[model samples]
Target: MLLPAASTVFFTQVFAGTPGGVSPEQAAATMVAMMAHGAVGAALGATVRLSFDRASGWLRQLRVTPVPQTSVVAVDVAVGMLLTLPPLVVVALTGRFLTGVRLAPGEWAGLVGVLWLGSAVFVALGLLLGWALEERAAGGAVGIVGTVLAALGGLWVPVELFPSGLRAVAHGLPSYWYAEAGHAAAAGRLPPAAAVAALTAFVPAFGALAAVVARRRSLPAVAG
Candidate 1:
């Protein structure tokens, strides 16, 4: 997290002061978007971990323990949420001190809080993939999946830089809305209704799908 934040700050510094230099506000917005990207993409590891546990029969072993399956799943998602903090704090600090982008303390808190909450969509996605796919397949797919989501979501390049058609497509993605929410919060405003609605819809949709997959996967163990 620190490494990525440092690299972004370095790039922002290099580009500052030129004719087309990144403005402080743009840099701040980019940092906020990147924070959301890192938070959502962080769950890719949970996919791999879940796949490995399933492959190793650890999930099956857990069935014999006293802990409920819902508890196990909740713990995994909660851990993913916790993972978002490091990147959020690192990038917030990097933008504040290194890049000279300032936000009120309340704005910073709101920014972090929004991105952290929106991350549930992808965390659920990671869990769904882990539960649904083979270990080797999940491992191979996660990197490509994360990269594609980030690219299309406008984290790697600003949507403003994209061609018109691509920009239209970006508006439809949950990742795009996720970043939009970050941008809004960083600016000390409520996230757009579209962003809030998109995130609200995805969270439960992905979570329900993941839950269904987990229940299906556990059925064989229960019957055995």
Candidate 2:
């Protein structure tokens, strides 16, 4: 989430003027990218933690309540959004003060919304990981998946920094779209509406998968 270390190399890279004549404005874009990545990464962690509860038979207990499984899922998705905010605040403040970044109020709000909404995509992924993997394995999965997604999606570095083929592949990931939405907000514009729309589309896609997995996970317990 872009922690501050006034003398550290990481700090220098982000706050120092961008190399190769990249402008401050351009460099500032990472603020949004970091926000999206940090939020989604944290959401993944939360999902893993919650999954342990499910694995331990916490969620299956709800089967008697007559709540549509989708409703339970909706709640998890909302919780993921809530989880994104606090870390986002820390990241925003750190990026602002540590880097001396400035943006309009609207821009700040836009980026926050973009990251918050985009997080649902990862949260849904967390659901799949949670249900699919063993409880202990899900813990490791969060780290592995976060690292891979970050590197491939421009969450760790700018997509422009990639070679052509890699960048093409990155474009296909939902993480890239999330980063794009955040970067566009940082640049004081709306991310492509299509990208935002696509993020919305993923909620249902990922959510449905999670729902299916979650149901399967519930089956043995219900049958008993």
Candidate 3:
């Protein structure tokens, strides 16, 4: 969770006097971006854990237990939402204490809220992966997908550094919007409407797709 924050510190220090050195301000934004990346990546655990649960037949058992499918999914989503916060809180603290970021109280609250909400896209994505893949494949898929999302979304490297074509492509990803939304909130502004809309659209899009896939597989029904 803190690995990305730590790496940001290390890289900023290493390049402090170089032409490529990051400004203290940009470093702070980068840290926030990395935090967003970590939160979404952590949310991917739902995929691996659920795949294991499926392999163990726990989901099948739930079907026989009279549990409302909506209750089951709500619990899973609630757990995933909770899982995202530790990194957000700790990393925000590190930014304040270690990196000397100084946002207003409202800015802090807005930033946390935006990032937390943005993670819903990945949480829904995790459920999709969970329903779609076997346990053995889920872990590797999460690793690859998370890394690719981070890289392409400009979480690891700024989109400013990308070629024009690639930057255009990055602008289309939810992860890119996720970090952008965080950055906007951290700077004391409402998140960009386009970003918020894209993320909003993706949650149900991924969710609806997951429901269809799960139904086709004859797994337990997933509540929307």
Candidate 4:
């Protein structure tokens, strides 16, 4: 509900500045942001779901299984990634049909890459939040933080419309780069090689942080 509303509102605003309406590029970019935001929501929800199950002793009831804890996390990530695809396709197709948005082959490929990379980042961030906080706290925190970041990161609106200082701060977040990469792809412009490198770096950096947090929590507690 929020995703479609955000995309529609964004397109309407962008179109307001044009003679007729938004260009295909603007529409494509908005679609990419909408899809990516949906993926982020799935990833966050999956992480919280898994965390709740773990905290509730579901894992222990399975007995001493051969599956590693990390493998369990991997399964959660895979499930979240898979769950995101349908919504992405639905949003993309709907945007194209309703708004006459079109993407070239190269632009489409770039858009897909952005969605994958963006999903990876959000999944890692979700894992980190889940491992670092209690289940209830983690879910609430992720929901609130994700909503604000999505709004301020230009996923819900163009950053250019934001105040200068706020926009500058937004640029420091990973979401900003993800949105920028999508926009570049939608415009049929090749993103800088550096942007790809930065995204690659962020994946492992956050994933490792989440792994470390999860590992620490898995350890036996010391008597205070």
Candidate 5:
């Protein structure tokens, strides 16, 4: 949260006024994607923290309780989405009043909706990582994954500035589609159907990964 929020403030202030910037729209376009990307980091934080719970055998205790593990996961994802809101309000408010970037009501609707959908994609990813990685490794893994995705996915830098090859790679990442969707929404235009479809598809695909990990976690350990 600190990293993304701090970086967002720095990057937007520094880059929003680049010389001969091809598009003023692009210059002021950080808020939408930044909000969603921050949510991904928050989701990862929740997952990594829960990984410690699993390591400490708290999850084993949960098995005796009435709550389904899926319910726990759902709660975590919802909390992750909520975690995104404050940073977004802060960043958007700063962008508008401090940086002079603005969005219309409709554009705000699209940006926030698309951003949340994007966060949903990563919430699933975070769940999978939490279940799959050992507790000792989950924290480092979460940081690395979030940073790499944000850097390459154009959450920090616009995808347009990437070299052709790098741009191709960025397009293949879910983060790229997330950022692109936000960009489109902010411009008061819908993102391409393919981009929207890709983010939608990723949510289920990553959810399946988490489901697989959850099943394994529930299995009895084999004796040597």
Candidate 6:
């Protein structure tokens, strides 16, 4: 997470100081990328926790509960949300200190909200991967794949740097969408109402998918 955020801050400052100044829109875009990076980090942390639980047989014990299997995914998402703050603060401060990025007080609040919302999407995706794989080794594999995709998706580097074809593919990924929303909020181009709507739709959609995956995985296989 710091990797992506630091890269964004460094590049933004570098570009802003060059012949072409970094516009507010561009600065917001960089923030959005950094926020997505933080979200991915949160997801990775959750994956690690789930992997540990599986390896230690803790997940098997948790499975004995009367609570729905979806509860596992919910717990993971909750933990991910809790884990998001430190990295969020680091990225925000890095941008502010290094790039001298400033936002109105209201915009600052909005940016934080956007970051949380984006984190929800990544957390849900992590939960889905954990439930779908149902093994520690599989979870580790998925985590590695996720990290690579994040880099390819421009979470570490701006999509603007990608070739036109790869950039188009990257745009279809959730990280890109989250980054766009964050950029809009940070840049003040997104209205509060619109920002709320985007997050409202994204969080529930991903959450539901995670719940479904968890429930399906919990069911015992039937003999043919």
Top candidate, metric lDDT: 3
How high is each candidate's TM-score? 0.91, 0.85, 0.93, 0.83, 0.87, 0.75
lDDT per residue for candidate 4 within 36-109, as digits (tens), equals 67767777776666566657766554336787866777787887677666666667666667766777777766
lDDT against the true structure, per candidate, is 0.81, 0.74, 0.83, 0.70, 0.74, 0.68
Question: Ranking under TM-score, best-scoring first?
Answer: 3, 1, 5, 2, 4, 6
- Score residue 45 of candidate 6 by CA lDDT: 61
> lDDT tens digits, residues 1-224, model 2?
44312222254364455556434574466666667767877888877665676666657777668888668766877777788787677777766776666888888888787788778888888878877777778888898998888889887677888999999989888889988888787788878887888788887898788767766664234333
User: Evaluated with TM-score, which candidate comes out highest?
Assistant: 3
Clashing pairs in 6: none
Give a tens-digit lDDT track for model 6, residues 1-224: 57757776777887789787997666666766776677677765665466456545667676787878567656776788878767777777777777677888877778777677567766766666665665546556655766765777777677888999989787667666666677767866663554456556766786687567655554442224
Estimate the Cα RMSD of every predicted model relative to the unseen true structure. Answer: 2.6, 3.4, 3.5, 3.9, 3.3, 4.7
TM-score head-to-head 4 vs 5, winner: 5
Model 1 Cα lDDT, one tens digit per residue, 1-224: 86558766766876786788988787897688768767766866654478778777788888789999789887888887788778878888888887888899999899989888888888888888888888789977888878888899898788999999999898878889999999999999999999999989988887788778877774234233
**Residue 169 of candidate 4: its Cα lDDT?**
75
Query: Any residue pairs clashing in model 5, and if so which?
Result: none
- Among residues 3 or more apart in sequence or in different chains, the pairs in candidate 4 whose N, CA or C atoms overlap within 3 Å are none
How should the candidates be ordered by lDDT, best one leading? 3, 1, 5, 2, 4, 6
lDDT accuracy of residue 140 in candidate 6: 63
Q: Cα lDDT for residue 106, model 1?
A: 96
Residue 219 in model 1: lDDT? 28
Model 4, which residues run further than 4 Å from truth? Answer: 13-19, 61-63, 218-224
Q: Would you give me the overall lDDT of model 4? A: 0.70
lDDT of 6 at 60: 68
